[model samples]
Target: MTSRQPNHKIPETNIKKRIAVITLKSPAHLYHCVPIACELAKNQKFKVDIYTDTEQTAALIKALTEDYNVSCRIQILHPALGNRLLNTLTRHPARAKHIISHNQDKFRHYDCIISPDFYTAPLITTSEKNRPVHVFTFHGAGDRAYGFKQQLCLYDLILVSGPMIKQRLGEEGILDCTHSVETGYPKFDLLHHTAPKKLFSNHRKTVIYAPHFQRKETSWYDWGLEVLEYFYSSRKFNLIFAPHVLLMTKWRRRKSIPKRYYTSPHLHLDFGSSNSIDMTYTQQADIYLGDVSSQVYEFLYHPRPCIFLNTKKVNWRHNPDFTHWQ
Candidate 1:
């Protein structure tokens, strides 16, 4: 179902437009959204509110807003206990359903909903009158085919990071009738000054082996263990075995991470921690080794050596999914 395309005429008076910025699924979505909410909060014509579920998310919102020095109403939501309990068993595909089921009336009153994801709003909810205009700020700016292959046309407005994303979405015809604007990466605007932890004792060069969570395309399902063993046994470089946040987010419940990976001083294995989402691994690693994780781009901020492992013997060259490889 499609949202109401933002056809509302610009207000000539001082009436404040109410907007809701939601940060759900906790894998770098908040970083992309805080700046947008902060910017809107600066204007008198807009009344921005931040809605989230977890204490971790609320705390993050507080910290980020403090950094920006922008104050707005932050609504911390506690979804039904059953939904929270169920979310622990499966992936986050059920999150949107809970958000919609729990906050239907509250969301309908907003003039707009600015989310870090597209489908998190209209992708799940049915089209109905009084629904807020969903403005999705595309967060996963990676080259994975999943990024471009989605039904992005559902949102009322799409905010992209750069021209590359705009061009890619336009080429895919996702922008045919959608209202989108390139606002640049809002996360980057808040340059986090927090330094990474001192993991290894030695002064050896650090290497981060960050793999994506996708079962079909990620190197973790096939080559993850081998990579971990290689770094653990070799001990030549300090290895940061930090996979995508979603990997542990989903699988950490069903299976337990082998304790041996954490035995070595050279091996620093993190599964879904605040540091994992923050730029701790990205800033500390001297080299990047991974599959299809978008965090590689963040690691490239300092210009380091990167090695992308192709677990599946697919022809990635000239493929739109592997555009970042080019």
Candidate 2:
């Protein structure tokens, strides 16, 4: 009898599936997808990469990783056009084109791509070779018609918060039952576990006046100053005026707060803060006041008293644009 040596080869243990989380537009959008990214990064079988367009988003990603004790690759997508003058002339659509053109090649190498917004649908769907499975997680629960556009059907998988979203998407004939998954809003997962810090020292009820940025749809262009004056003049409640993040991004013409309004101790005006995306205002506020912003849904998580401002006062009862108001 002779002992025979078995032939064996060591298998590679370093292989990990790669995924990409792309965030554009605002920090809120980035925050909406952080929970998913962090969860993916924590898994040993996968490697996660986050691509953001702003410094604030990069900082937020770093903080999230430190807080969660997970590691992932972070990339900031800066405008490829070197000159600011040329960028200003080209405008937003051109900038978006440039970003997609610069990153489309790298994105194709990933096994999967997750996006919180619909803007990236074209990039993922148009790729003819090595197209990764595209997943879309809506950043909000708003009933805007744009949310139900034909582009939504391009995604391989759509993660929705509740049956309401599924129903809406189905009605539009844009979603396939086979591809949709009912996953509760990931952003709220963080909001529910995290403790909200007290923004004001006083015990008085706090009202968060968060208006949208669009001149046509926003309350800011209509009764923004009037609303502020009402809150400033009244001493019954403390006010936190936090408008949409894009309100001051490019549009310089905005309602200037009167000096008298600032004198009031009950009023706290925040144009845009780092904590704006953290739901600090929504959690601390006793009442929710807003135009068409989806932050209203966050406030409604607690089921508090809400006041929707219809600046246009266009019969929203029949308007599909104001379906959220119903």
Candidate 3:
């Protein structure tokens, strides 16, 4: 009998899916999504690419990829040279918008794009018919209105930490249950791995005053220095005045810290550092103080005392904008 010739077509399951994990926001947002890329890269059936806007972030990604023992190409997000100077001048959210505008064609080629931000899905030419699926891993489990912002409706999948965030997003009419997944804050794993930091040598209780950056909503503009002075003079407690890492990034004006604050052994002033965003201050502080910063929730991992500052005198009672207190 004549031998039947077998078809030479390769199996579809053998094809590796291309996934892009991107973070255009500040370093703080990187913790939310980089580990996810590392985990995804472990699967040989998929190819993962990590994209960032700054060398600072590229270095961070390399360190993390090595720490996690994962393999992935790190791509820097940049506009063309023609607009690179203009792009460098603008700040984030705007800079993020510019990158998306320039990279639409490049992004559309991926099978899946994973980010810890809302910038991607809204700007890219993504439609129901689009090839690449957009997944938004939340940068924070923050309590502020930004957490439940209207822009989140653009993504195909949204990851939430727990029931509180899920319910709040759902009630806002932005989150569809089908698109939302309760991922329970993966950065907690990062925090778990990080050793506790010691800010003061004495046994005095430590207070971390971490305020939000958005000047319109931040208490930093009106009362930040005053709050620092109070802690500086009182020496009763060691103070870590590390505002949200983005605070200085957004504030174009450089407010000089008094020489006294620098000399005070009780005062630990950190404008921006890896310790600021990695829950080092949150984990170590005895008390948490902030206006709208989300590190308060991280501090509550131990259920310590918290004091919220309402410098604007706005009624936050029963207000959805200040829903974390609820």
Which model, 2 or 3, shows the larger lDDT?
A: 3
- What is the lDDT of every predicted structure here? 0.76, 0.77, 0.79
Q: Per-prediction count of colliding residue pairs?
A: 0, 0, 0
* Candidate 3 local lDDT, 222-273, one digit each (tens): 8888998999988579899998877776344334567788789999988777
Per-residue alpha-carbon lDDT of model 2 for 1-326, expressed as tens digits?
Answer: 11112122223477877889988767888767878999989899889999987777799888877777889889987556664357677665225546766667778778778999876766543444456667889888877776777677767778998988898888887664226789888888667446778767888899999998878889987898899989887868999889888886664444366777666789987777766767888888999899898888888788889889886876889676677688
Candidate 3: lDDT over CA atoms?
0.79
Error of 2 at 196 (Å): 1.8
Weakest ten-residue segment in model 3 by summed lDDT: 1-10
Q: Report residue 280 deviation for candidate 1 (angstroms).
A: 1.9
Candidate 1: RMSD to truth:
3.1
Deviation of model 2 at 246, angstroms: 1.3
lDDT, residue 156, model 1: 73
What TM-score, to 2 decimals, does candidate 1 have? 0.87
Q: Write model 1 residue lDDT over 49-142, tens digit each, in one string.
A: 9987677778878887887778988886655678767777753444665765777667767778888765556543544655577788867678
